[model samples]
Target: MSTFFRSSLRSFATTAKSAHHNNHRDNHKFLPPTSFLGSWEAPKDPKEAEAKLAQLRRDYAKQVKELRKEYIEEMELMRLEKQRKDEARREALRVATEERKRLKAQEAEIRAQQRNIEQQQFRETLLKERAEKLEYWRRKVKMHEEKKAEKNELLRRQSSMWVDEAEIEKQILDTVIATTHF
Candidate 1:
């Protein structure tokens, strides 16, 4: 594993050196003034190399720490955003459900009112019909009573006429008998 890591690092260094050389060749005239002069030299001794490696390690550690902090902060921000969106969605759904229920309740109330109105109208219609029927029956009864009164008056007149005729006949018979006896 150590040999593999060393080989990989060597390959990365060779690639980075070739890329740098290519860029330097491509834009030689646009190079910075500082690039004209070499600022640092390679360490010679083992102690110097060790010190440089230690410094590089320290710098790498600081960069990794900063990167980790930034990554953690970004992840936390994303989580908070997701939570806020979820809460907003939940609230929206709750409001929609409540609105639907309110509308349904209002519809039910309207239907109830309509039913009440219909029932009242039906009752009124029935009352009016009953009143009309009662009036018709009263008129019929009055007509029947008038007819009965007229029949009774006719019967009474006929009976009185018969009595008067019988009295007249008896007087006439008595007169004839008196004349015969004389």
Candidate 2:
């Protein structure tokens, strides 16, 4: 395992050195960014190498923690925005439903009022028809009474017997009472 690791590091160092030399020769304006991992080498002193490794580990851990905290804060803000939108949508829906109900109730009231008006008009028409029928009957009765009175006067004159107004009124009253019994 140690041999494999050393071989890999040697190859990486050789590649980096070649790239660096090429950059200088070409007079490049910019060099490629270096990674911390590629810069690390095994020190001759084991203790110094261990200390260096530990420091690098600490830096990497701190960077990871900071990124995680930022991600959590951004997620919390997004969640709050979503919740606010949902609440607004629900409120709008509730208001719309209430408005629909109000309109329906108003329409029902209008229909009821129209029905009442129609019923009243129908009743008035029936009363008018009844009044017309009663008037017709009254005219017919008056004509019959006039004819009976003329007949009675003619009969009395023929008999040479004159009936007084009180007697005529009594006879008319009796005729009215007799007709009412039927």
Off by over 4 Å in 2: 1-37, 161-182
Model 2: residue 119 alpha-carbon error in angstroms: 1.8
TM-score of each: 0.64, 0.59
Cα lDDT tens digits for candidate 2, 1-182: 99999999999999999999998989967766877647878799989998998998898899999999999999999999999999999999999999999999999999999999999999999999999999999999999999999998898788677667899899999999999999
lDDT of 1 by residue, 123-157 (tens): 99999999999999999999999999999999988
Cα-lDDT of candidate 1? 0.92
Q: Model-by-model lDDT, in order?
A: 0.92, 0.93
Query: Which one wins on lDDT?
Result: 2
Task: Please state every model's RMSD to the true fold in angstroms.
Answer: 13.0, 18.2
